[model samples]
Target: MKRSFGLAFALFVCTFTFAQQALWGGTSIVSPEIHENNTVTFRLKAPKAVKVQVTGDFLPTQKIKTPFGDFDGPGAADLIEKDGTWEYTTPQPLKPELYSYTFLVDGLKMNDPNNVYMIRDVVSVTNVFIIGGGRADLYKVNKVPHGTVSRVWYNSPTLGMDRRLTVYTPAGYETSGKNYPVFYLLHGMGGDEEAWIALGRTAQILDNLIAQGKAKPMIVVMTNGNASQEAAPGESSLGFVSPNMQLPKTMEGSFEMAFPDVVKFIDKNYRTIKRKQARAIAGLSMGGFHSMHISKQFPDMFNYVGLFSAAIMPDNNVKSPVYADLEGKLKAQFAQNPALYWIAIGKTDFLYKANEDFRKLMDDKGYKYMYYETDEGHIWKNWRIYLTEFSPLLFK
Candidate 1:
């Protein structure tokens, strides 16, 4: 009986160890392994899969056609099989940046089984890895003193609901007990309070920038730009409704009108500099549109304004005073002499023409503004870069 009990106990321990190994692809297997040369190797244990491929932002983009037009999208690389595992290594060293990828097993899309790091962008989820020794290092947590990121609830009388926001108080905020400036970072269409923190790496960027003395230590308030949704899907009482691209009130005037509620709530709650000179507003794509309209509608609210790949013109059919009087609002906004009115867009963005028209309109009006152009289209990579660049110029 003693011999049997001992054997059984040993067997159970071995089984448990094997289960743990199988769950995360034990010591023998690793999905994404970044090499010293900056090349990446991806491996998958797909003994049965006839074909497997890896797709990610690291690969060159291929032109994909959509209802709008052809646009560049992430391409796939085929993996070679050896024994029971499939593997592939990039031929060239990838640039030092954060990249997300997924495995395609026999034509089915799936996340990496071995690597657990991942983030959700509006509606899609993908595994992510960073190649450090460059700008991507800012996104990684280092030895610097990190700030406190809080999910705070605020009552929005204008919207008639309690909404959620992700706020980042710089390091030493609680201990120092001094009022700091605030930067309102909005999100693009289909994004929520968590978007900038997740996809844009807002917290990491601000933390690193502040530590390096490149940016002012300020509070960053990331709000749920979708006026109809109180928060990110599954975050509110919405009950796990899958996020989609067809979010309502994304660019409507409702969000712009209710923007002051967010500002007032932050000022009243946090130790904040309540004046316009200390306030900055910026966003990407749809969020950029909101920032532009919000700042113009209340020019005294933010002395610093940034439009990152902004949808310059409002939909002609959306009848609202916020979208009305295109030049009149700018005239009032500029007359106050805001510290900065900046615009930036990707060269190949579908909205490139619209941004150019916006620039032309500002030029014709003789408005003093700054413009920046990049190589990519309307994507998060550019948005992340924009945030890094824009934050340094704020409150300086």
Candidate 2:
């Protein structure tokens, strides 16, 4: 009788283990069977699938015409039907960030009903996946001690309008009485303060970096790149201007005048080390253009200027005679208290050459700057990595 009872107990344990499924918002769903290399493998029990395709915006939206094979290690996707079920894999190893994907069935876009992790993009949902890699680590949201992201509304006397900015305070900020340096980090076109909060993952990235002793603890301020009042969020008729250096075209609101006022407001509200050496400004793409513009415009404001894949090629309008030639301005900016100027770009980025060209201009002008290049392109993957590489060196 005792032996029989033990056998029944063991059977019950096995049943529970086999019946377990990944829970999504409380309901059990398909759990991806992840491989050692972090490749996800799953089988959809759709026996009647005429044709199945896994679609992701990560790669070019062009449909994957053939079965995903070993294009790279543990990378590739395959669509095979066996025993009334369809199985698919990725065509190449995914980047080390969360990817939004959907399965295309007969021209219909559908999410994997079995996958637990999903987010709504408009009316449809996309399945999310995390690729494995050290550079893309910030994309994966983990439950670490997070920093504070606050949306600040201020009266911008400089721009003559009430402007908004996003500020990220690192952990231990609340209790730590010691003030920290400020890093004025800006975003590119089609982005605002929320860009760094979301796509850049600045808070999480900084959290992990500071925790891992890889980066210094500092406050990050993300501001709107557009200088026009019409460019605020949805105020403009043209949704987002992708123009290169036609900068002041979007700078209609006199962002140049209002910028110093924003700095004053930051000094008032935040416990910042309000000195030149304690202040740094940097940006990407359009933001990079602004950083170059603003840092030169207000030579005494910042001690460091970082241009991540900057699009700075002295434009025709802002040419030598117009807004003060590049050489004289850079000289004055670096003359009194030139901060550490750091620039980085991806090897495949469209802005790669632009960055190099800007570097040459800086060299020709005798401006000191640092240049870094990576393997990725003009995407979030490269920007996040750039943040990791650039942040630690600030406020040193």
Candidate 3:
């Protein structure tokens, strides 16, 4: 009886060990398999899931001319399950670009566990993959000199708190011992300092451009423009607040009032060109609004100003007392004789009319500015393109 019991226990141990190995070994299964033809295959091992679907920007709507007419809609197809695994493949080749995707398993959205490359945009998180070559190659880490990105904290007297900002120093910054021009890059509403680096691919773009001798080497500073918050969502001392709460009125002017403090801190801490000619400020959407107000308030602070899909308000629609004298302030700002006041927007953007009216205002005031129009609406695709074009024109 003792011999039989001992033999039984040994068999049990072996069975348990094999089961554990098999369970964990399945984790190596690759879900997103990028093919040489630029087509991608996504797989998910959710045997018990009732439904599964994959969606991404790469599955943009296509026009299909049916017997009745043409219909434009999503091209992505649902994943079919087989042998306890759901799989999907793109019907056609995708363009070379960074794309974000998510999987829906039985109506529950989830990230691709197999793909470790992920990014957060505002409230949503998604897995990402890159199709190499072409313009997307510019967004990839190439065999060129790279820049160092750092998250730096500084005191903000205007907001009466310490804040965090993302700074990108060029590759040779430590050894160059030369003062580099600075670019104050801001993100749209619902975005923070990380937006430019994550979604905009600023570091990769700068590295490629500088290496190609297309853009001048400069420091890019990305700041959190949400004034009520001391830092990005998770980093804020006030803690995470729901999206519905009304921000304090003081938050509206906090960044504008603290603009000087930011400049002073940068100049004192980093090796930067102290003159306005060596400085540039640009942003997208709400950030564009801040840039406009910041440059208007401190006319001599930045020589090159860019507004990408800017949220420009009409004179009467201006609510903040800080911009009460918009026209007069802008007139005075232009009088400072800055080098470039560039505005860019997509034709399909909802703010197109607003930008048009703002451009008309600039025209009426005889303020020299550059205007650029593109093909998309208010999206990150256009914003990235705008940055690619805008950065080359800066510090020239």
Candidate 4:
């Protein structure tokens, strides 16, 4: 009887493991199948569900009224049911870019059963796919000499915390036996050390650009600009914490004051050039604000400065040395004659006016800078474009 029972249990486990149905109550069907023409087909095999809809960025989106602000709410389309499968294909070929979507089974949002690639931004998670050919190709992994990404810990004397950072060293840095320039890349508000690697595809872009000789092989240091957080959610001793936009100590001069500590840690540990000429700093949104202030406050520390859709000024009530002496610091920064001071913003960005005013200040002071204007608003897509365009101009 014991042997018979054991055999039955083994059969049960095998049946559960090797099933034709998806683990989530549906027949397995391939999703996000990209064609040579860049058109995409999404499928769901949920016959039990009354309705299934697909919502993605590839579809048209509208600005919906919200308490916080106006947010892009992409329209959803019902999938046609053929036999047991619910399927939908794009009306037109999708552009070469990363697209995300999810199946709304009877109003319940869920990821694709067949597609495993997903990305989590702050809290929301969605399945993602890439149609490669153009700029999206840079966001995809190519057959090239890749870089090394390390989640390193460093002590921050300014913030009085042990901070975690993501560092990307070039393909041959370990055995190259040569020092290289370092680019300090900062993320936007609500982003952590993992932002650029996941959202911006920094490693893949750096590897491809360096292989094509478009960008210099350098170390990219991505730091957690959120001063209060020790690391990303679930990454530190804090355990799992829900990410929120309400963060303190941001742009309060604490990060700028302790900025040297990050530099010191990198210089001491990495094989960096260790000089003003070989150093560069850039960030998007909040990080852009930090980069602008940090580079100006420490004028001689960085040779390249980029501000992508930066918040040029802080709230009136907040006080800090980092925001003070704006004209004086600009003069001092330009007096040093840095290699590249790039300011890029999208035409539709909410910060476009602020950047325009900042540009006027630069013009009024005769502060030379390379300005780039793009289409779209203050979003990750624009920031990624700014990164690819900005990095090649560094360490030249």
Candidate 5:
């Protein structure tokens, strides 16, 4: 009887150990699983974690009205934890767009390990997934002839550094043996040269547009607008710093004075059309400001100019010598009879008033320009849409 009891106890211990091990191990987890209905389901395996939550751009932002002003409130959903796994499904179907998300496990923010696809913006890194079709399909990698995107370092005597820039050469660029027109694309305040390629989905847009014959096949040069930085973060010895770091006075120095060097380098290296009519310049936010100033500074250099939600500070308010003769500069630029001078902004943008004031100034000066308005506020969605609309209008 004693031997039988001992054997029974051993059997119980073996069974209990097997059950505990099974709880911690299982098949691989598939996160951000997209359903046919456009709903998304996210899952994470954190058996030991006490709490788990998920937040993403797809989730609606909670707005808080404080005495100071209205601001974005925190909106995160707690995940259901069961059997060593956490999961959450969106209550509503997500719209057709590329959405980024992150997981918060016990208050620690992390990217989804199971989702290999990720995107790095100027400040944060997050995993990304796309849903549905239509406009979202334009941002995807379709079966079409693609372009080549390269990060090239060039001499910038004005900035006194070897700066880096992103260049895009269209399909058949090498074997076609044709000199293509050039587009100088600039990024926003916090963005680097990689911004357009990573977040803007520039290559995909250009490829699809060119394949459809909606836009001319052209070379795109994406320059680092930060006058103080020698290169994008991680590519330079300066090391990576927060995007909100206090910029040096030189950081705000004249990009117009230094832009000629960029043009000179591209002309010397690439098979460019080498004329104002074949050159275009465009940017978003601070880049829009740069586009305005740079085109004004060099009137004969660019025939097409696009300002995407430009941060247009009035000449009277600016202290830089670059804007000292703003009126004369703009007059000279407009006198050149450029092909297209386009400006676009969202109606609810914080800079709406500033843009309105700028447009009034343009009207007062009798300068000709094309204006476009959208439905949203200052955001990447508008910028991408602006790019899609603007590219087809260039070098026609």
Candidate 6:
């Protein structure tokens, strides 16, 4: 009996270890046999932490402030740490779906230690699961025509350095052997060429949009906006945004100078239609600022200009003569041609007023442009929606 008890205890330990490993290898966390409770609970163990906050893009942010209130015990309650674990319970039940979440420890980003669900590409991060609960149809990869992304090298005349750009070609471009319209997409400060394709999923979004007949089939070029070789400066070797590196005085030139060079290179290398209407330019955040600056400056080069949550009007604190020159560039485009200028902003975006105020300036100048206000704020989730909505109208 003693020997049998010892063997059973050892077996139990082995089984428990195997189960933990399986949970990470695509195994379900919740048992299907047990019906899911709509009132879900999240418990995170970070004994070293003093404060924790749960941030996610689930609904119109107006309701997010009081989200906990809509669920249970208290309305809009802050998650509290108990027994060295931070826990929050949903007032109601959650549907089956996966949600992206981040934890804030003393205002720093740290992944959830307790969550088992995770996805990895360049980085291994955690995600939450609410089984049978998601907008799976819209956020899914389908068996539709796909797009190809390539990393290319180029020389920047203004910065005096060779830089790299990532370009995406939609399906049929290779087999059809025909020139297609192009969209030059830009990234914001602290972001690099990989930001759009990786975080924004530009390729997937475009493929789905084109397949559904919501967007035109076109090529997208995502380029590094920084003129400096330091790239994102003080980030990791992968080069993400961090402290250090002052904003460029001649940001317009630092980024725009590379445009003509990239365009000339693409025309020489790829089967590209060399007409203005066949080309479009757009971006988000810093990228959006690029769209506003580059499109306005090179009106004869591109027909459509999209600014997604952009800082169109220059910041008042900017006193540099180089920064002031942007006004002259905008004036030139306004005087030349202002067709197809599309501006979109999330209602809760910090730049919401920036976009609205800039639109008013465009109106005063009689610029032909489109303005959009959606249910999101300054986040990748909203940018994904913008790409899906903006791409279909291009090259039309």
* Best-fitting candidate, scored by lDDT: 1
- lDDT of each residue in 57-161, candidate 5, tens digit only: 787666556442243433689899999999999999888988888999999999998888998877778898878487787788999999999999999998898
lDDT digits (tens) for residues 288-371 of candidate 3: 988898999899899999999988752354366667788999988999998999999987677788899999999998999999
Deviation in angstroms for 99 in model 1? 0.3
User: Given candidate 4, what's the lDDT at residue 85?
Assistant: 92
Task: Give the CA lDDT, 0 to 100, for residue 85 in model 6.
Answer: 71
Q: What's the lDDT for all of these models?
A: 0.90, 0.69, 0.85, 0.89, 0.86, 0.67
Q: Candidate 1 residues 96-201, lDDT tens each?
A: 7889999999999999878889999877899999998677888888889899999999999998999999999999999998999999998887788999999898
Badly placed stretches (over 4 Å) of model 5 are 1-27, 48-51, 62-74, 239-245, 249-251, 314-318
Please give, for residues 148-204, the per-residue lDDT of candidate 6 as tens digits.
889887666756767787899988888998888889988765567777886676887
User: Each candidate's TM vs. the true structure?
Assistant: 0.96, 0.74, 0.87, 0.92, 0.86, 0.72
Residue runs of model 1 more than 4 Å from their true location after superposition: 1-5, 8-12, 15-19, 22-27, 67-70
Cα TM-score of candidate 1: 0.96
The parts of candidate 3 lying over 4 Å away from their true place are 1-25, 61-76, 238-251, 314-318
* Per-model C-alpha RMSD: 1.7, 8.3, 5.7, 3.1, 6.6, 7.0
lDDT of 1 at 180: 95
Worst 10 residues of 2 by lDDT: 66-75
| Candidate 4 lDDT over residue span 252-324, tens digit each | 7777788899999999999999999999999999999999999999998999999998988888998987899
Best by TM-score: 1
Write the residue-wise lDDT of candidate 2 on 256-327 in tens digits. 455787788889988999988899998887678778878888888998888887767544544332245667
Off by over 4 Å in 6: 1-53, 59-89, 92-99, 104-109, 113-136, 230-252, 315-339
Off by over 4 Å in 2: 1-33, 42-52, 57-86, 91-95, 98-128, 138-144, 228-253, 313-324
Q: How accurate is candidate 4 locally (lDDT)?
A: 0.89
Better of 3 and 4 by TM-score: 4
TM-score of 4: 0.92
